[model samples]
Target: MSKFKNLVVNLSLTLGGLFMGVIIGEIGLRVASIEGYQKIGDFVDSAPTSFHTAHPDLGWKLKPGASGEWKGEGASFVRVNSNGLRDDREHTKAKPPNTLRVAVLGDSFTEAIHVPVEQTFWSKLERKLGNCAAVKGRKNVEVLNLGVQGYGTGQQLMMLRKKVWDYNPDIVVLAFFTGNDVINNSPKLEYDLYRPFFVYNASGKLVPDMSFRKLAPLDRNQRAVSFVDRLPSWLVNNSRILQVAKKADLDLKKRQISKDFTVLRANNFNPPKDAVWDNAWRVTEDLIVTMRNEVVQKNADFLLVVVGDPIQVNRDPQRRNKFMQENKIQDLFYPDKRLEKLGNREGFRVLTLAEQFKGYTEKFQVCVHGFDNSVPCGGHWNEIGHRLASIKISQNLCQQLKQSQLPKR
Candidate 1:
């Protein structure tokens, strides 16, 4: 009885020390200025009206009628409509009379939770297009933003068919952010696997890969949160130790993938030297062409907008030049030029925005990208960036519309 009592006392002391240490650690983390700790475990949520939810077809989607405050680079209240679009109001399947409809597609840049809905590029484009002669007889213009965060070209194509066609848009603009869309298209390159992918088959034809749906919750690591993710939000949010561990794990994974897939590196500007990268580019090009063909078949115009990455549009010429020298690339617009060539070959209009954005940066020394909390000139576009994109896109789109000689419906 004496020995047992001693053992119990020792065990109690050890557990008590650990409990106190954890409490102190949690308090320290909350006191620190670390960002993104209030929500932990998973990058997304699965609840209805959550930021994102599991989809039977698309892997994940903006939960229809979801509302939340988005913070990172900037703060904005994002409200998803009943149709799962980040918009002020629900859109109709049928185009309204005397209204010209334009559909925009891409990833987070197009979704743009960093800024207000009225300040997004597509929203501003609507107001701009309304004043232009692009639709000679149309009294109004509607630009539908069909973008979702973390989406690649494969998922965008799926969206074009599953949701976009129902709206009967007169134009389809694909906002291609070259920074990660290449990796996003490749299963071997992209870490997130909850979404759909296209893989080349034995006959060199691209086929759909929907295996993610069959994986267990933990394996997917997306779409649905796992047991680890179910830790009380307050505990996870306040625990410095847990936050450090999670960040370390994420960094390790990113470093492992970066060994082959370097983001914003020379590989993106130059030709692929390996099969994996070659396949990634091929898959992306094929997906773009497929989207264009589908839109053209429906008598709608297709425009591929090569959105500029922040590094490519840095206000300081020294930084831009240094990056170019380190990357050993003569041209910063290599990806844009390549995509422009593809659009020319495939009979769709292309607009390369990097050159314009770079010029704007050089002339004004103003940063269009990044938010107050992020690295300087890094991350998504700010209000100025959206405005510039809207101005350029509206101008180019107006020209293309006039050239098409579209009928006044």
Candidate 2:
């Protein structure tokens, strides 16, 4: 009986000692502000980390005139116009005479909330186009950016119908990202929590549904409820020590899972291949054809640009090799070529930044938009990336517009 009591006492003492040690370590790490102990969202109060107003049609959109100080992988002050656009200027219903207006549509690549408004491609393109217009005797060139982050192609189509056409554009540019878009086509799992999605019907026609309910937005009246969404993370993240411990735990989990991890590829979100991707090609084709028809009915030209993911453009040999081999990704140009083929068949000009970006990457490290460019990193575009895109698109667009407006000669 004495032996048993002693064993129990020792076990309890050891556990208590370990608990106290953990508490002490946590406190020490936090007080030091040791590196890699902070949650990324703790620095940014924007979409993905925060919720915006919900729409039954487009899934989510920033509140018009919503301005927030942003700090993230890249930090910038973000502002949205009254029209739910991330531009500083307001667009009127009437486009000025002798003006060429272009409306850009897509996901975060086009939205680029991480960068300043002036630094965005559409804004930069707008500035460059103004100069070009001045030389060509055109009055003005307006580019409306109608990008919402995390939007799927179907949601983009819905947005085009619900909001964009009011701008009376001369050109409509749709940017496609190959990363998770393929899987975004269907709303099978937690997709409803993300965005309004589409599914393949019995006739194999793409059908849109927002039938699944979205999470109710945080209520200002219900501070307790509203704070609930952020509390758990906030509590842990505010303590740098807990953040470090959590990160270490996550890193260990990732390493362990990575051994058995099958790369989801640009295509495979697994079950979504059938639920989402199986109809992705057909649905995308239909949506583009429909969107183009909608634009042409208004006498606007449609241009499609396939944006390369960071993985496709990563200069790091180790990370690049892993993505390539895991996804059985042979050609880096696979997305561009596939999109170009579709555009050709549809009789629209499709351009890709793959070759253009590669040319620039030969001299510079073309990495994802983030604070860091190291391996196991990034999927977004930084300011430089946006600048590169703006230059290429602007030059090409000006040339195309100038040629199109050549007095029908």
- Which candidate number maximizes lDDT? 1
TM-score, per-candidate, Cα-based: 0.81, 0.73
Overall local distance difference test of candidate 2: 0.69
lDDT of 1: 0.82
Q: Candidate 2 lDDT, tens digit per residue, 1-409?
A: 9999999999999999998998888777657756444433422222453425755566568778888877755667888888878888888978888888889998888888778888888889888877775335547778899988878788888888888878778889998887656546644322324456566679976677665343343321121122223447667556655566656755665675444323545443122346335556666677777788888887888888778777666666677678767666667666678778888888888878866775676567655445552233365777777898888888878778678657864
lDDT of 1 by residue, 1-409 (tens): 9999999999999999999998887677668855332334334443223577878778889888889887765778999999989898889999998878999999999999989998899999998987788575666899999988889999999999999999999999999997888888987777677778988789987778888777654556432332334567676566677656556656665566555444434567767769988889999999999999999899998889998878789889898788778778787777898898898898888988888998998899888898888767878999989999999999998887787676767
In Å, residue 87's CA in model 1 sits off its true spot by 0.3
* Model 2 residue 385 CA deviation in Å: 0.8
| C-alpha RMSD in Å of predicted model 2 compared with the true structure | 6.7
User: What's model 1's lDDT at 116?
Assistant: 95
**Runs of candidate 2 exceeding 4 Å displacement:** 1-51, 133-135, 189-194, 200-205, 214-262, 266-276, 366-368, 372-377, 407-409
